[model samples]
Target: MTATDGIRVVTLAGEIDHDTGDTLRHALDATGESCPRIVIDMGQVTFMDSSGINILIAAHRALSEAGGWLRLAAPARNVMRTIHIVGIDALIDCRETLSQALSD
Candidate 1:
């Protein structure tokens, strides 16, 4: 994870399933900074399941309640399809590029 202009950019690769859900939650939500704004770089993420969706939902809610927000950036084709099908792209700010997400 790296912070870019106060927006934390977390890069995750590989499949995100039940096995990795808790870890993903921690990586995304275990922030000590108040009002943490984060952009998840999903460009490298190959796949994701419902567990990943749940974790994202929880993190989005937590961040929003804390006056922050979550953005998804550059998801792979398959992952993007899943995100769209699940309606997560609507709930979360999804960008086509990491730079776009950071700027947003």
Candidate 2:
């Protein structure tokens, strides 16, 4: 994870499921404390389950309480579908590219 211009970028790879949710949760928790804007790069993620969504929702809540926000950037189709299906897209901003996410 890295931050620039008040936007933190977390680039995730591989699948996000119950097994990997803890790691992702930790990363998000660490950043959510201070960063007002977080952009998660999901371009490399091949899959995402409910567990992954739960982590995102938790992080979103944390950031919101601090007057911060979370964004999802360049998520793969499968991941995007899951996000949309779960209505997370309505709660968070989903960008088409990392550059766009950072710029916004």
- lDDT measured at residue 77 in model 2 versus the true structure, 0 to 100: 88
Please give, for residues 1-104, the per-residue lDDT of candidate 1 as tens digits.
99988888889999999998878888897467788899999998998999999999999999998889999999999999999999999899999999899884
Across 1-104, the per-residue lDDT of candidate 2 in tens digits comes to 99888777899999999999989988887452654778999999999988999899998998988888888999988889889999999998999999988885
TM-score of each: 0.95, 0.92
Top candidate, metric lDDT: 1
Give the Cα-based TM-score of candidate 2 against the true structure.
0.92
Please give the distance, in angstroms, between residue 5's alpha carbon in candidate 2 and its true position after superposition: 1.1
Candidate of highest TM-score: 1
lDDT of 1 at 65: 88
Report how far off residue 39 is in candidate 2 (Å). 0.7
Q: Alpha carbon lDDT of residue 54, candidate 1?
A: 92
Q: Compared to the true structure, candidate 1 yields what TM-score?
A: 0.95
